[model samples]
Target: MAIDLYALPVTQVSGVKGKKPEELLALGITSVGQLLDYYPFRYEDYTLRDLTQVKDGDKITVQGTIAGVPQVQMYGRTKSRMTCKIVVDSLFITAVWFNRHFLRDKLTAGAEIVLTGKWDQKRLHLTISETEFPGQGKSQTGTLQPVYSITGALTQKWMRQTMKQALLQFGELIPEVLPAELLTRYDLLPRKKAMALLHAPGSLEQGQQARRRMVYEELFLFQLKMQAYRALNHDRADGVAHPVDLPAVRAFVRALPFTLTASQKQVLAEILHDLQQPHCMNRLLQGDVGAGKTVVAASALFAVVKSGYQGALMVPTEILAEQHKRSLDRLFEPYGIQTALLTGSLTDRQRRDLLASLQMGLIDVVVGTHALIQEDVYFRQLGLVVTDEQHRFGVNQRSILRRKGMNPDVLTMTATPIPRTLAITAFGDMDVSTLRELPKGRKPIQTYAVTPAMLERVLGFIRREVSAGRQAYVICPLIEESEKLDVQNAIDVHAQLQFAFPEYRVGLLHGRMTASEKDEIMRQFSSNEVQVLVSTTVIEVGVDVPNSTLMVVYDADRFGLSQLHQLRGRVGRGEHQSYCILIADPKNEVGKERMKAMTDTNDGFEIARRDLELRGPGDFFGTKQSGLPEFRVADMVTDFETMEQARDDAAELVRRPDFWTGASYASLRQFLQRENIFTGDLLD
Candidate 1:
């Protein structure tokens, strides 16, 4: 039967058809095409070994046949050993398999075997440590062996055979996404041939080149999608031209308790320019935590209100929304612009009153969480919409907020700073404004890495800080005890801390708590009633508590550098000296490097760069697609050059009429259509 690689699911393949392959699905192998694309995690070198080239103490693999029956012998004690003579060309070497009496039975005369072990040149013997049977053929016969990542339920042989069969069956039918001319110009392998070579490459370099071809396709398609999304959204949405309220904005800025840094001033100026434009403002405002993003939002809100249009500030967490609401209300009160809070934690009466005021335009600015996305929530004139922690929200959520008003201006903010190269690749469609400078007099958090033995000292330090009338936070990687992870969890840690520190008030926070419960816990922590708060990474965003000066993160290696930076920023909010203790003993080099990078510098961009280098883009970017498509093969970190090239190529390609109307470009067009990027006039 002929099978189209794109149309045939992996379950239809032989060896997998009758096996209920949920295990393969768990590894993200769902189709014939995907299975072929599932590249090997590693390759084992199987270069042919020459007996004459063997050196003392060198470990190598040598294939040979048993020249004589293996002899069983006992040592001075009860230990049994099997000794055999193997012949390779003119040399006959002694092979010893200790505590392996079965070898005497299996190693029959003239039977071929491949043994890999350390050689004892003085004794002329090869220790038979690893064995390869006849079925495990070419892997030991001087060739590279591909090792794929799989669950215990799936064996390496099964995975390799599955890929080989899939390639043999449907490789020729795999559809190409790129235009022929473009593929030729880049010297990329054809999609069909690339998959074939990737599954069974004659050489290591050939396999890598084939993989690079796939990476280029994935990246190029992504750039094309992003550029199309930009064309559809930005080119069509012409926003109301709100004249810059310079005097009011200046007054709001001057009213801020602390002065704005040069970087903040520059970013705000760029945002203001976007706001007054005839086109919709699709701008990303990224800054590290404590970079005064709240003040910038306040100024933007003031300007929008001064122009007689309401504003909306949506955040990921209810605590953040309420915090922004109170702070904005106080900041804008002197300017006489009313602000209201709309969140899930609000009482029915409170929400009803706020909604009424918002509808009447009495509320010039409304701060909210996902509550703003509800169908009943109406805005009188939402001219400016600012979403905090924008990455936490999906593309559809932002689209829904934009729908509440006619081409409303948007200014999304992220406290997690992303590097410039990555930001351009991810958010190339939007103008970028960055806040890099922190407010003056804010001290840097002293970061340290410690093992389990230092936990008591860290706890003592936290106790001293709490006794001195300051607050602290203990963050756990897990919300609850995970039997599989074996890491410290917030619930168990909180219980242990409460018992250990009986004199102080301790609070617990995690994602499983209800909105009201989280809000109350945050309120207690902010008020200093809960002197030491034990929580999870839910507080990784903008949780401002000046009194909280110390932070201890358990299993810090489990988190990425960007997350570690954000968690550390939770402290050092006040004038008091702050400290961040990482309770970790990383097992690998990557984990240790992450911890070292965390303790080395406090700069978020630097940490982001290091993170991109250490963990690649997927883990660095997380599920926060940031309005960009997730890539399967292309890592923006390693393929930054290719990403840049693809980005340029995509920009040029979209400008051509052929890209939209040519017959060869039909598949590309269909892909963009499915992505909802090339569609037009949705802004209206």
Candidate 2:
């Protein structure tokens, strides 16, 4: 009888007993099926190679006989090195192992073994990383060895043996999820064959083929979930059909201080069209920093208000909320649109009055931080909901705000330029509108990378800029000194700057400060009461100060490209020539690449694309904050082409008449149901 792989516990496998099951469980591997799915993160090729072809730093595997007596040397109290001479393909070479003194007894002269490590051609040496004694029945020559991420007491040898035993027992019993048509269309290996190849591929090409199939499978399933949600949202009939007064919205746009960019106008049109539809406007408005997303969002809010419905704008931070409130208040005052601000810092009585006004329809639009989603905060007729820096809020938080109204239109705005592949995967359920053009009169920020040795010069430059009646910002990665990291801290930097520029005031800001303190500090900086503001990344998204012309980031290499771009954006908002100086001494290639990318171009999209390549999707926007799905094999950067194919296929499949019920899709439906990919009435 065949075993049910998904139901069989991993402990049922040979050697996976006692604490072994618990260790595997830590990796989310509780069932035999899951254990098989735990594919190797990397592979080491142990195929025997010619000695003459090996270079000094080439990592190669060679089979040889122990040619000399092994010598063990003890240096430090707990340090030792065992060295021996090995003969491989009639060529003698030295093999060394560090802190492995026990190997001296086992590595007898004339013992036949397979060794893999970096070959030092100049010294005719092989630093032994792995050893296989042929007499002991462990020969891995001419094969690729799978390397897995293991926990306590789980070595590579044990993991490989257990996996081999599991495959022998239930490999044939593993079921296929994708239909036969897709398998033939994509030229994919069978599910069982792919699993076998992934665990123990005969060649590198076979391993790559196996990985391709798995990546496609994961991406396809993920896109299916996204497509289903999108379909469900589109099918909802309870969405508001707001009266889109184009002329009124146009007039509001015309009344703006500056003319809207062409990109902004195009996106505004898309947003207004969505407002007139019966389905809720589930759209994402993304642009580079300094792009006019707010104007477009304000226009949508105006249209909603003109239709006799209130609007709610939620921001991530109180400072940003207050800034938006002040800007919108100034813009909407002439039109008689009442706007109110609600934040956590408000007093009890103040909060009560604001809630009452919101509930009584006295406020046309409400701008606040997370306070807008409170249960007691009622909206008389909520029509549209706009969230700035949408990545800062979780899906549940956004959903709660949307639920406060009767299918209100949601417009999520972000200054971060999301890559096309990530947008399709992460924000796949929402329609995307991009504004790539900056508003007129905005100058590109001049960015430069300098070493710590040039700190004096940077300070002198900042002094000169401040002397000219302009403000400056100095950013640090940490708020206080840390034992582990040696990067500059905000508090110490603030003190140093105050001492260096004794004539000017340097205000300190960090996340640890209270809201009122931060607001006060920002107020002083905006009014030029403080000539320089020293802070952490809390100012990454703050009230814009056009007078701040110089931004000096200490240890800028410690920051991601997107973050560095955002910090640079704080400056260059005014008419004066702006500069961003990155003070860093990068130690790695990735760190150097970040600095180069920052200094190369001021385009946020290009910076974001490079950042995604450097940091990957998981760290791009933080998975929890951005709601990006985690996949085992599919990478949002390298496997983008495959993702696009999967997205197109999933979109087509979800539209089929028998997508949810047909025999061809029975396995797909069952898999999605068992995995709980589609919840509620999505599958129905």
Candidate 3:
């Protein structure tokens, strides 16, 4: 159904009458429904009151009689904020208003008003920046106050008032979506009731319940959309079955220098089964670092080859692509699997040769970066596509690759094992295969957190490692010092190491270096030409030399837990024991906590959980990194359990797809469309 403009009601304050709806639309507040549905970003709870509970300088609601008159000072104003003071319950608190002083009149002396604001405990004074009155009732300040996201033209008060008015006027449009039976069974309030509680609740408990209802609803709807997509895909006619020759893949694995681990074999079996499915495969491969995702991917590629079809592997960066190509080339050579590399960095002659091989169907396994998805590129018989660190690429890029084939099986691999809650909420539409165990003979990288005082010992250890014919890696925080202050740099550290240990060779690598320079440095380190390599995180995944055993990270606190884990993965690649030392400051609690968490557990999943609990979803998941959904109400971290239940409900709803044909589901879809929560970007 098309959007119903009448579903949203107009408010007297939405516009000044003569201005444009087009103008309002530009502000993302076009429809009355949008205005009503524009939920608050946060809430300020100032409903609790009582002088007995109030401490000195506390921003509290004192119900005592006002003993003095308020004062308004003509303080010099810059571009914002005004200076004023008001007395409530015989206590003095500074009042600051942005541009509006109409508050002065409403907050008269001895007027028995409740002021809500911040306070300085040391100064024994409160900054009553906001005011409330009994006449305004609970609208001004209640258990939960709606704090809508606002533009310059819309103040918090304005948004609240406009939403309140819209709610009052558009009573007929706010239809309920959940069944009456389910509502009563789940003890959930109606949307209208929840909205009321959200804006103005009589008690904190009511506001929490209302929040729970809204969050669950929002999560359920999102999950339902995902399940719908899954259902729709399931209904599509599957492609021809591409049978997998398990014997061939097993023989290839058996011929390998190392034996496949239980987890690797398990995941490989799942991938093989997926490739054999008549439907085009859309699988997610989640494996911890050093869990042998590459071998599993190779096995899938073998199946593709056995089926008389070619496979394509895409990486996010040219460096990583080159690395994967080199690694896969070695593995495929013994099996007579014709493999080739294609990337932007390749010379014209090289690219032409590679393209020729690809077009001729001679390259059985082609690995490259986004260059594979270029418009000019064509595949002879691309049967399967493997994307390494698939999370780094956006959904659009993934889709573009899929469109390159006749619906080839897609196997996306990620080094990070996403939390289960995130996988459900963010990647519910895709099938997932997890490689949870590390391969045999891999030593656990011992991790430690130390202060600057231990720096000398760390350097001494590096010297000892290099002297023993093994290599070590020292990662600096930055390439150059900032203008703010001069900090240690990779270049400077390399020089320092060379000078201190004149007996050993030291090399430096950073992001600022040229590709040739980075390659040369990496080549040197790989061949053990350089005993010690000092660099930035650029080498975090660049090379895989087992000789490097000692890993030292300077200012480890600056890096996220997952990032630190990734860096630690650079070492301990060999059978010998390896160590990761994190040098940090002990006094900084945030830094200390991050370091402690890293040291406390070598488990990536545990680290991720702690990272979430300590820093929230944004910092833990690296919003920019994960591309995870950012919900204002639903938190995948704190609300994991609830999100699971919502996901189940979503699945059930999708099984009964006709439920959305109802007017209520239409309205629900309309609400989601307005919020961009179910936008096509998610599935693209």
Candidate 4:
């Protein structure tokens, strides 16, 4: 069947009016085919009719009449309620209406209609004011109805009507993208038939099958697209191969002030192998907070520089860029390697000078945000591109930078730990390196979760830390509770802390503040000018201060387990004994569970596994950043077995590259392109 793409209407439902076929088509509702596919936002079940199944106190749907007049009464000044006696067959029940004046007229005495609502079995009362139509159906066996996405102006009734019309007109117009043989083999429903049953299933079993087939197709097509994307990347681009110089790297390592941990050395070897490979490198470097990822990144930078090629380290924030520049400059300046920082906040002269230096190849290492990849900032001999946090960069932007010249090797660094199983599925195209150990002599942060009642003791601990010449961070649960609710805001907390500790310098930082203002506050804190930094979670990922040893997180029960762990990691970086005090309300069990997870272990990997187990796959440590193919039905946490099967299926498909060719591949490719999974430019 040929699809009349031109005949199909694509009008917004808001402005829809009179149902003239021509007017409907003019508004882009050309045919019944388009109308039937108009899905609903939700379904209301009024199907059940048996009143005996409903207990005396149970709320239910029943067909009855207004046997007696409604008794009305007023409540306070504005509210009123009316209760009417109703009966269905031999069963008697009472129905009540609240603030329903017009209902008195709408429901008259001796009227026969179906009422949809709940009943109070013990009270022998029912709330029968839901609907007048007998639209709900009863299941011989219990089943659930499905709801589709919708806009405010379009209702379930409108959708059902449009769908009915579309089925009458253009139900046969939609062409099947899946091959006939595949459909039969998979026992999948045809597109038109599926739409018919999806809107109006004959049985609960049919609905289940329909949902399973649709969800499978969605997930399978997604996998198919991701495979095609990987294929395009594999077929076209050639990676720059710059093998590690072990002897020179060893010499540099020996000259460092601290010894490298076994974990760090192992990760370096994995990265070195990728750098030496012929394929363009796409690798993720995951380390716990303060696990020394910067040092590992520096080593890769050194390797890039030693190979006579320029390297760039792109961070997500300006403060992080400055921190990286200051730290890298100190380490590399001794080796005569020049490092330059470029951020949006830089003055015109500074930016121009930096760009010129980069163009001239005078700056061997460049560190900045998206500013580094802007078209004007060209590298003379770009070889390596290291992104500090993978989540901040999109695939398109990263690909554009890789296209800059010579297809520079890409390495992405993240502080979020991911389990090995998911890493294989989500980042199948990339290698992985993990630094699971902290640097030697790093103090273990002593963690505790306390209630607000222990405020004085907490204040005394802070005073002791401050009097010892160290600084602390006091973070609120939110930036502003005024905009939201039930969360501690940083602004209010800052004001309260200012009054409580008048002698201490308390500075505020949050998303609401200007970038320059945030930078100034951060600089002051770093320079010890501010003894207390009161802020939101904006400081979770990037900010690094060794001197700040204490972290007091308010409403700690409100944050995620991984987030709580990350916040706790902000401390215990320096030699001094650091502490993280979690101020949580005792009544919150959910919050207590999360806080307990932190006090139990500092291992990010274990915490991540437990988080996945507790919250399910959707809330895993770094699943949001993992970029896994979006699955509507497959729960990564609960459907681990199915996920494993999907991964295996994807791998098998990749191995047989020619299996998805001809018209089959054309449809798959179109689907992928529509979903923005694969770009048309294979080389890019």
Maximum-lDDT candidate = 2
What's the CA error at residue 216 for candidate 1, in Å? Answer: 1.6
Question: What is candidate 4's lDDT per residue for 1-684, written digit by digit as tens?
Answer: 556544555442333455544544443445444555444334455565587676655545677777888788888876888888887877777887787756777566887756666778776677655656333353322223445555435455555655555555556666666556557866888866776677767666676566556555555665565565676676444777786787877777788778889998898878777777766777778888888888888888898788788998888777778889998987787789999888888899999999999988999999988887788878898988898876666666666666665878888888767777666556655667889888989877889999999989998999899989899999887776665567678988889888888998999998777778988999999999999999888888768788999999998987878777878888887778999999998999888788788888889888777777767655554444435555544455654554555555555665675655656656655666676755534322
| Greater-TM-score candidate between 2 and 4 | 2
Query: Each candidate: what lDDT?
Result: 0.83, 0.88, 0.74, 0.73
Which stretches in model 2 have alpha-carbon errors above 4 Å?
Answer: 1-21, 51-59, 76-78, 89-91, 118-125, 152-154, 658-661, 672-684
- Per-residue accuracy of model 3 over 442-482 as CA lDDT, tens digit each: 88888889888987888888877787788999998898776
What TM-score does prediction 4 earn? Answer: 0.80
Candidate 3 total steric clashes: 1
lDDT-superior candidate, 2 or 4:
2
In model 1, pairs of residues that clash are: none
Q: lDDT rank, highest first?
A: 2, 1, 3, 4
Hey, what RMSD does candidate 2 come out at?
Answer: 2.8
Ranking by TM-score: 2, 3, 1, 4
lDDT, candidate 2, 1-684, per-residue tens: 546688988887888888889989888999999999898888889889999987779999988899899888899887988889999889889998888787787888888878888888889988888888876875788899899998887899889999999999888888887878789999999989999999999999999999998999999988887786776557566688887888888889888898988999899989999999988888989999988888788888999999999999999998899889988988999999999999999999999999999999999999999998889989999999999998888877888898899878889998889988888888887899999988888888889999999989999999999999999999999999999999999989998998999999999999999999999999999899999999999989746999999999999888899999999989998999999999988575677999999989999999999999899877889656567787877788999999999999998998988888789898788766775656532221
Q: Is candidate 1 or candidate 4 better by lDDT?
A: 1
